[model samples]
Target: MGSKHVFVVAVIYSLCAVAVASNPCVSTCAGRPTGDYQSRNGCNVYATCVNGYICDNRPCVAGTVWDDTLKRCEMTSTTCPPNPCVTSCNGLVSGDYQSCNGCNVYVTCNAGHLIDNRPCPSTLVWDDSLRACARTSSTCS
Candidate 1:
């Protein structure tokens, strides 16, 4: 009977692990703003963080996946992978812009608040000199 109980516990743990792996909405919003963020687990899943609390997992439509660079759902690409945005709006004034993670993704500040993670158009990247997306492959520092 004890062996059976142990087996059951192990099975339960394995099942939980599988669930978490397949769900793909794994993010802790402790210090993050209230908004939707692309999940690193999968391309089609996103997480909703509200006031530093996790809200729920949102899935993109059929044939679509969450674009971390654009902070929106777009058609899946051949090289789709989880590229999460790690920018913060803290200490930034309104109209300030910067990119984190990569030059293809960026964030803006609004009245001391953080905005969504925006992405440059395809084949384009963020250019701080022009303060806009431009056609280039240069890495952002």
Candidate 2:
């Protein structure tokens, strides 16, 4: 795959922290707080909303910050950058989406972005079409 854009980012703690910050009550993206107005210079590279800040039903992208003055998330660089949406959820690691084998075998993000290569349990594996876990035993009764 070819890379499209490269930009700076201010992570709050990790990807998960950013996800929670996306909530209506969140106050900041990294360290920059959300309010009725924040100058472009005041905004960080990336930020979430606080007090239910909603722009087009979406949060600002990473490598950019929420511009309350402009009423949108704008790029902190030369121009609006690529998708800065980092997936943080349920207090899990930035990329740890679903758990398997009751929390042992699971999927997660590498470096809080890309999907990690960790596999399922030794006796279990993933079935993509089924989108579920299955036993590795070739012969099953």
Candidate 3:
């Protein structure tokens, strides 16, 4: 019975310790609009505090901007990715893209944005029902 009690107490203490130390990030006691300092295990972060302020916001490299998702500088995409613009168009890569609406109507992306936008034929219009180009005078049916 004594040994069992000791084991139970150890397990509870371990659980408490794990819960308290689970979060890796430490924040200033002041909290949100979070202050400029945080520390863990006696090690202070942002050690380059100048005049009580740190240069946390570093400038991005030329032609690149800080990405919220990556938290780093990267070239801006001209078109949206993962589903590229215009269902039929190819995914944007190195700023090149291809997407089509219906059929003849298409959009191209250069640098992750639309460029060289036009219809495949001056007298034709996209027809979703047939999934192909149709004459301007033709009905979708």
lDDT of 1 at 113: 74
Per-prediction TM-score: 0.37, 0.21, 0.20
Q: Tens digit of lDDT per residue, candidate 2, span 33-134?
A: 554433222234333446454222243465455544454666632222122232333333333333323322445554445453356667775432122346
Task: Give the clash count for model 2.
Answer: 6
Q: Clashes in model 3: which pairs?
A: 78-111, 78-112, 78-113, 79-112, 79-113, 89-98, 89-99, 95-111
Cα lDDT for residue 109, candidate 2: 53
Cand. 2 TM to true fold = 0.21
Clashes of 1: 2
lDDT of each: 0.53, 0.36, 0.34
Candidate 2: residue pairs that collide = 24-52, 26-50, 29-48, 45-64, 62-84, 95-109
Candidates sorted on lDDT, descending: 1, 2, 3
Error of model 1, residue 130, in angstroms: 44
Weakest ten-residue segment in model 2 by summed lDDT: 3-12
lDDT of 1 by residue, 1-141 (tens): 697666444432332233334332335788877877655334555677887888544877865766555667787532233222225544333443446657776666666577656887878877543446788532243
Residue 13 of model 1 has an lDDT of: 33
- Cα-based lDDT at residue 101, candidate 2: 34
User: Which model, 1 or 2, shows the larger lDDT?
Assistant: 1
Residue 71 Cα positional deviation in candidate 2, in Å, after optimal superposition: 7.7
| Residue-wise C-alpha lDDT for candidate 3, range 23-124, written one tens digit per residue | 222222422343332222111111123444444434445544333333334564111111112432223222222233333454544444565445657777
